[model samples]
Target chain A: MKAIYKREVQSYFNSMIGWMFTAALTAFIGIYFMAYNLFQGDAYFSTALGATLFVLMVLVPILTMRSMAEERRSRTDQLLLTAPASVTAVVMGKYLAMLTVLACPLAIACLCPLIIHFNGTAFLLSDYASILAFFLLGAAEIAVGLLISALTESQVLSAVGTFGLLLVLYLWDGLVAYLPSTAGGSLAGLLVILALVCFLVNALSSNWKVTAAVFVAGAAAIIGGYIAASDRFAGLLPDMLGRFSLLGAFDSFSVDHVFDVRGILLYLSLIALLVFLTVQVVQKRRWN
Target chain B: MIEVKNLVKRYGNHCAVDHLSFTVEDGQVFGLLGPNGAGKSTTMNIMTGYLAATEGDVLIQGHNILEEPEAARKCVGYLPEIPPLYPDMTVLEYLRFCAELKKLPAERRKEDLDEVLSLTHLNGQAERLIRNLSKGYRQRVGLAQAILGFPPIIILDEPTVGLDPKQVVEIRSLIRHLAKEHTVLLSSHILSEIRAMCDHVLILRKGKVMACDTPEALEEKLSAGGALELSVRGSAEAVRSTVLTVDGITSCEAQQEGDTVKMMISADGDAREALFYAFAQARQPILEMRPKTATLEEVFLDLTDEDDAVAAQAAALLADTPDEAAVQTTDAEQEGTGDESDL
Candidate 1:
């Protein structure tokens, strides 16, 4: 695991992806910092970080596009797979290496709060809390990118796919707001979401029996509950999806100056789920 | 030691490795010889745990590869068809990474790295980036990586492909040296290389094992009906009439060039002396006489070639040999002379 981690980190720098990612991220964050805090005389550092979230959507894919996809494209995954290491260890090594690359820019951003403190009265605790949330948000996004990278062998496709997903995620709250809030519409939406989940389960496990059972059980429970109490179904779909908005979790820290513990857990769980999926993608490829 | 049991790998409906089973004992150079698309690489990949078999099990040193992959993989070193290399790394760095990935002890890692480097003759090119090195050197780097931990079993899939003649010879010699202490399993399509380097050869065609034995044993078994080529300074009709009188002669073919007639005689036993005496009595001088022995190339072609007459002859020869039901089954099934479902 250490060997893979070291090699991944070295390759990132050797190929200039690390430098390019860091330069682009720092440059954009610096511009936002200058405009929000330094030039506009705003004392809050969290607002600058909130503005820099868009930069991460572009740069995080650049950092992670070649992680697993290039290994498979070049046939180097054979060496890793045939080695005496487990697949989970290999995935963790790569994930940690990508996290390290993300750490570089976050490390630089740590100083932004100090700069704000020197310029004016700064809420250091809340600002640092928001920075922590920002780091976790980036970490979760990187995990998503890593999973996308593992799904394909072409680096360009991995990058584009990750960017597209991240773009949707960036606009997740706005998209969820457009969802129907009526009781019948929410019931219909929930059934479609349940069916999509069943499809994903079928694709991964390729077991029709299990997928059918899950689909039937989920649809029955949702329909029974909707029939029992129609008022409960009203606006339930949009509310549930709104709760899943990744950017909304960070908004508590950056906008409201409160440490959202639930948001931190969401970020951690997202990271864990995506990393597990990446490992499964690699493991399942062997059987195929 | 490795034991492969009824290994079957299928890609969609096309079976790549069909119920193949073989074993490699300690300290023997085992070779999988086959034509292209004969499932050699797929079998190697499954054995090394890089790919899963559709239905089978591979036991490495008593551990199942699928059930206990890490332990099983630890007992073997595999160099895939394409050398799995990181182009950004130097040869030395890549090897070091491999050494660590293979879990070599820290104290022995340096010594083993040095030993493999010298063994593969990559000491001079160790510092060069793998991307900058030529194909041969990159192959050597891959070989060095495989031999880093000095595992007891080393499996190479077409290791000599894409190499020049001299490099092939070097790699062959290196493989021979490695076989002294390690059980080596290699695959090649080159008949001469298998004959030169392998102690046991398994000939495969279309994912079925046609024959498996020592090179010499296969040649001896396939060369059942001896053939002789005789050149006589006489008319073709006269040479044919004289050759027909020889005992044990099954068939004779004569071709006349200028004043000389060349006859190819197939006999169940040695008929050289009888043919000579017949020519002597007829007053027709025998210009030249030579016995034809089957080369490995001929045997390979006869077994794999789709021509009806040649395949029939090869099947007849195999059927004549004692106690090779597997070979007979494959041959008979391929020629449609046996039950088709037996395959």
Candidate 2:
């Protein structure tokens, strides 16, 4: 794991991706910092960070585009896979290396809050906590990019796919808002979501029995609950999906100044899930 | 020691390796000889723990590859068909990373690294990025990577594919040198290359083992399907009729040139003594008689070619040889036991 981590980190710098990512992100964040805090005289540095989230949606993919995809494209994964290292170690080493690259700008961003404190009244604790949330948000997106990279051998496709998913994540709240709000509409929406979940389960485990059971059970519960208390079903689907908005979790930190412990847990769980999925994807490739 | 037991790898509906099995003993160089798309690379990949076998096990030093991958992989170093190299890294950096990835002890890391660098003759290119190195140099870097830490088993898939003749010889010599200390298994489509390097060769055709034995043994079996050419001063019909009387002579073709008849005889076994007396009795002057032996190249082509009738006939004739017949009986016994275990 250490060997992979060291090699990945070195490769990142040896090429232009690391420097380009750092410079691009820091430049965007600096513009936001200058516009919000310096020109607008804002006291809370989190507002500047909130505006820079879009910048991450674009730049994080570039930082992680080549992580696993390039290794597979060039057949370098053969070396890593045939070594004594386990798949988990190989994936973690790469994840941590990308995290290290993401940390570079964040490390520089750490000084932004300090600068604000020197200029005027600064919410140091809130700003630092928001910075932590911002870093976790980037880490989670990096995980998403890593998984996308593992899914394909084309680096361009990985970057584009990751950017598309991150775009959807950024607009997640708006997308959920479009969900049906009436009781009947919510019931139908829940059934569709359940079918999608069952499809995922079927694709992953390839066991029709389990997938059928889950689908039947979920449909029965949704219909029965709707019939029992129709009012409880109103606006449930949107509300459920709205809770999963990744940017919403970040808003709790950068916009509302709340620690949002659940939000932190959400990012942590997403990272873990994506990393596990990446490992499984790589393992499945070997079998294929 | 490396033992591949009934290994099978299928890509969707296409079976790449079909019930293939072989074992490499300690301190020997084993070769997998096959044409392109014969599952040579796939088998090596499975043996090195890169690809999971569809329906078999690979044991490296008694460690099952799928069940105990790390233990099994630790014992073998594999150079895949394409040497897995990182272009961004210098040769030295890449090799060092491999040494660390192989989990060499810290105390032995530097010593082993130096030794591998010198062994592959990568000392001059150590500081150069792999991106700038030529194909042969990159191959050396890969060879050095595999030879690092001196694992007991090293598996190379087409190690000399892209090398020049001089570099091919050098790499072949390097492989030979490594075999002095490590058990080496390499695959190639080049017949002479295998003949030159392998102590034992496994010929594969369409994912199945066509034959597995020492190179000389394989050639000797084909040689048993012997043919002979004779020049005699006689009519074509007379020479043909006399040669036909010999025991074990399958066919005799005679062509008359002026007063001399040239006859080519295909036989199941040695028919020289029988033909000599028959010609003498017929009062035909025998000017020349030469026995034709099959070379290894002919053996390879005959065994791997789609036409199996000729190979089967040769094998049947080989079964008549007393010493070779004993080996076949034992092989049959081993197959019987293998079937019993499957049951």
Candidate 3:
């Protein structure tokens, strides 16, 4: 695992991806810092970080597109897979390497809070906390990009797919606002979401019987609960999905200046889930 | 040693490897010979733990590949069909990484790296990037990586596919050298390479094992003493009469062309002297009397070709010999040993 991690990290810097990612991220953060803090005389560094989240949606894919896709394309995965290393080790090694590349810009951005403190009154605790949240947010997004990369052998498709998913995640809060608030509408939306999950389960397991059982059980429970307490179903669909807005959790720190432990747990759990899925993707390819 | 038991790999509707079973004894150079799309690469991939078999298991040194992959993979080093190289790294860097990946002892890695470099003749190319090297050199780098820890089993898939004649000879000798201490399993479609390098050959066709025996045994079984071609300057009837007079000639085929006769005689034993004396006495001057020895090329073509008649004929010849008994007895012994090792 260490060997793979070292090689991946070295290869990122050996190519232009590492430098370009760090430079682009730092430049965006700098531009936002100048406009929000320097010229506007805003004392808070979390505002600049909040503005830089858009840069991450575009550049995190650049850091992660080549992680697993290039290995499959060049057939180098054979060496790693056939070696003594387990698939989990290989995936973790690569994920950690991408996380390390992300840390470079965050490390540079750490200096901005100090500059603000020297200039005037700076909320040092909140600024540092927001930076930590920003790092976790980017780390979670990189894990998502890694999973998408593992699903295909073409780097272009991985990049495009990750960007599309990240754009949806970035706009997740607004998208949930468009959902219907009526009880019947929420129940219909829940059924649709349940069906989509069943389809995904069928695709992964290729077992229709298991998917059908899960779908039937879930739909029955949802309907039974709605009949028992009809008022609980009103405005439930949008509120439940709105809780899944990943960026909304990060905004608790960057915008509201609150250390939300539940949000950090959400980010960490998402990273773990995506990394596990990526490893499963690689393992399933061997059997297929 | 390696054991592949009833291995089957199905790709949706198409089966790439179907009910294949084989064993490689310790210190033997085993060859998987097949034509294109014959599942040679697929089997190698499964054996090396790069892929999983659909309905069977592979055991390397008593460790099941799927159940204990790290233990099984530690005992085998694989050079895949494409070499599996990182072009950006230099030869030295790639080999060192492989050494660490294989978990070679830190103190001995440098010595092992040097030994592998000199063994593969890559000492001079160590500083060069793999992308800058030729295909042959890249292959050598791959071989060097596989040989780094000196694993007991080395599996190479078409190790000499794209090389000059000299490099081909070099790689063949290197494989032979490795076989002195390590069990080597390699795949190739080239019959001559199998005949030249393998102690045991497994012939595959359409994902099925056609024949599994040593090269000499396969040839002997397929063509028991072979046939003989004779050219005599005589009438066709006279030549046929002379050939018929020779004892042990099971079948004689004669063709006539204007005072010259060509005959193909299948004999259970050496009937060359008998035919020569009979032809001389009959005044049929023999121009050519050469015993036709079946080459491995003919055996491979007959076994793998799509023509059912030729395949049936070869199968019939194989049945006439006691080769299947030998195969079965060894298989039973392997099962006994496998059970004991499991305990």
Which candidate leads in DockQ?
Answer: 1
Candidate 2 lDDT over residue span A1-288, tens digit each: 999999999988889999999998899889999999999999888999999999998998898889999999999899999999999999999999999998999899999989998987999999999989999999999999999999999999999999999999999999998888999999999999999999978866668999999999999999999999999998898998888889999999988899999999999999999999899889877787
Candidate 3 to native Cα RMSD, angstroms: 6.4
lDDT of 3 by residue, B1-343 (tens): 8999999999999999999999999999999998888899999999989899999989999999999999999999999999999998999999989998999999999999999999999999999999999999999998998888999999999999999999999999999999999999999988789899999999898888988999998876644354788899978887897888878887888999777988878776688888889989988899998976555666677666665555555555566654342233222222222211211
Model 2's chain B yields a TM-score of: 0.80
Per-candidate RMSD, Å: 3.9, 5.8, 6.4
lDDT of each: 0.88, 0.87, 0.89
TM-scores for every predicted model: 0.94, 0.89, 0.92
lDDT of 1: 0.88
Q: What local lDDT does model 3 show for residue A134?
A: 95
lDDT of 2 by residue, B251-337 (tens): 777899999998878777678888899999999989999975556776666555544554454345344673344334323322222
lDDT of 1 by residue, A1-288 (tens): 999999999988898898888888888889999999999988888999999999899998898899999999999999999999999999999999988988888889889989989878998999999989998999999999999999999999999999999999999999999999999999999999999999978877889999999999999999999999999999999999998889999999999999999999999999999998898889888778
Considering TM-score, where higher is better, how would the candidates rank from best to worst? 1, 3, 2
- Residue A231 of model 3 has an lDDT of 91
Local error of candidate 1 at A51, Å? 0.5
Interface RMSD of the candidates, in order: 0.7, 0.7, 0.6
- Model 3 scores a C-alpha lDDT of 0.89
Off by over 4 Å in 2: B229-290, B307-343
